[model samples]
Target: MDLPVTVGIDGSESSLAAADWAAREALLRDRPLRVLHALPLMPHLLPARAAGGRPGGDLLHEVEHVLAMRHPDLRMRTEEAHDAAGAALLAAGEDADLLVLGARGSDGFPELRVGSTALLLAARTGCPTVVLPVEPPGPHPRDLVVVGVDARRPAEAALDFAFAAAHRYGLPLRAVHAGSVPRADLGGEAALLAGALEPWKAARPEVEVVADAESGGPGRVLVEASAKARLLVVGRRPAGPAALLGPVVHAVLHHAACPVAVVPGA
Candidate 1:
């Protein structure tokens, strides 16, 4: 069976936005869209509510109706889980093509860039995760996908994702490397950036490629590049026992103006 593009929602405006974005993504990939809502688990002694009265059932129904109306021909489904948010989403996304989420939930603080559940799952989920910004992006659409390239890390997974997305949308792929080298050494930086992207460029010759090397903090540089990009792609090494996300990935997930795709890598 083909894997669906799944999105986790919690009745927040941000989550609703993510659902909308996930619908478009599903349409682009020619896959089904799964809307999931994670509800707090109740004690075993309590009686189970009817399907209609289940917590979050109304929200799920509303989301389904809205997305179905907007995407008339899209195949869609909704799921509600009685479990902690992070665990529920992680499990739901295991068999999915991609997992999309809101930066924060309804209960999150307004000042937070991302919620704990989103942060946890983004670092730990086996599949790639797309986390939308706090507010849905505006109507200014650009035809570019930006991926951050790190010389020290193996970024094959991220490069592959970026290239494929660009090809799918007929957009240009910008491979950005944020090195701390002095401005005078930009020539060397550009050469290294080109070399890093060469394999993927050759793999997808139909997609246009732009190599950019900037002198600054990686996070800041990538976030700046996201301003004109439709999507920003970054690699996250599988989480260790501590489940730590690298600083650069964490920064972009929170601050990038465009939707951020966190692809799992070595």
Candidate 2:
């Protein structure tokens, strides 16, 4: 069976917007869409009692209806789990092609850019996880893909995701490295960036690839670049249980202007 594109919802506007984005992505990938809601069941309630009556339960049906009407040919399914949102999504993502979620959930403040669940899922999910901004898309968006590249680690997973997405969307891909590299090492950084992208460029000869290395903090540079990008791809090294999300990936998840995809390092 084909792995579905799974999206986690919590009945918040942010999650619903993610659902809409996921539907379009599913269409692009020709995969089924799975709408999942994890119900935080009450201690006294049975699993079935809180199955489809939670805040997000009704919204699941509504989301299915809207998506079905929008794309009648899209295959879809809805599921509810009596567990924590993060755990449920992590399990779902193991068998999923991609996981999409809102930056924030229903509980955060208006100014919050990302929620706890989104952060955890992005760092640990087996498949590449896309975390959307809490607010909707802007009026004018750039049709380009920006991916963060680290020369030392050379995240092959992130490069694969970025190139594949750019190919599917028929957009340009920009590989960027943001750090305080010594002036003398600029040439080496450039070469590393090119080396990191060489395989992807060959694999995706049709994708337009641009390599850039800037002098600054990774977070600051990537966030600024995201202002005009349709998507930003980053990588997490998954170092043990405590340090899964590195500083750069964490910063981008909370501040990226466009949708952010966090791919686990190989």
Candidate 3:
């Protein structure tokens, strides 16, 4: 059994956090860490200003050095490619045990891109992925973990990943139902979410489950939950209203104190 974590590093504060988070994950899984600093193929391959003026290769070296100083026992590798960050990481992920990325890049929205390499991988990659958040709170605070669940149904794979993580990390798992309810049906939201998590409850009888129906934004709710947690898990739907990594995800990516696992799928 070889557990491996592939973390994307680009020398940014967020990317550095990602490296640190991934190293801890790797250590926990009893796996070696691979600090992947992908070098874009060439100038045209990436926009002139994509990497903020510094060469991609330079960032890669910096990331490698950063990891070496922190985790001498950890192993790492770097690859250069012309593919998009998500595509490049996805390609390397073919044999990895897990993949990780920053919640969001420097990009802003509606033109801002929330479906970063992490989101793309979680949404499409065939393996488990964790999106390490770069803002508020802090690292693995108390080990409480939360996973966002859609009211319509619980994304099984996403929940499974979350549960496994919780179990492995010895953290309590909380299932969060994030959505808007009709003004008249406010009281029924908790019941609806409880009903939704029925199977998860039955399967993981030992794992603690708590439900939160936030009156405010779901992202804020998740981020708040994250402050006391070690990690947050979210499922990305393919092509529906829920499919998009909207505001909640965007907020969580930037503000979550702990590492966030963005598992893509409805």
Give the best candidate by lDDT: 1
* Regions of model 3 farther than 4 Å from truth: 1-3, 43-69, 72-84, 104-124, 136-143, 182-187, 239-248
Please provide the root mean square deviation of candidate 3 (C-alpha atoms, Å). Answer: 4.8
Which pairs of residues clash in candidate 2, taking residues 3 or more apart in a chain or in different chains? Answer: none
lDDT digits (tens) for residues 1-266 of candidate 1:
89999999888899999999999999999999999988776654222432344567778889999998999989999998888889999998789999999999888999999999989988999989999999666666677999999854548989989999998888998888887889999888888778888888788999999888889999999998998899999998877888889999999988899999999986
User: What lDDT is reached at residue 86 by model 2?
Assistant: 91
Clash pairs, candidate 1, are none
Q: Write the per-residue lDDT of candidate 3 for residues 1-266, one digit (tens) a residue.
A: 57478887655666777778788778777788877656666665553434566557666777778777887877666655556677778886777888887766544233432345656665566566777654545444466888887767778878888888887887788888766666567558778788888887788877887876656567877877877887788766554434345566667766777777766554
Per-residue lDDT over 139-212 for candidate 2, one digit per residue giving the tens place of the 0 to 100 score: 66788899999976788888899999999999999889878978677888888788878888888899999899
**CA displacement after TM-score superposition, residue 9 of candidate 2 (Å):** 0.9
**Pairs clashing within candidate 3:** 41-81, 108-112, 109-112, 122-264, 123-264, 236-265
Each model's TM-score? Answer: 0.93, 0.92, 0.73
All models, RMSD in angstroms: 2.8, 2.8, 4.8
Model 2: lDDT of residue 123: 77
Candidate 2 lDDT score at position 57: 58
lDDT of 1 at 157: 89
TM-score for predicted model 1 compared with the true structure = 0.93
- Candidate lDDT scores, in order, read 0.88, 0.86, 0.70
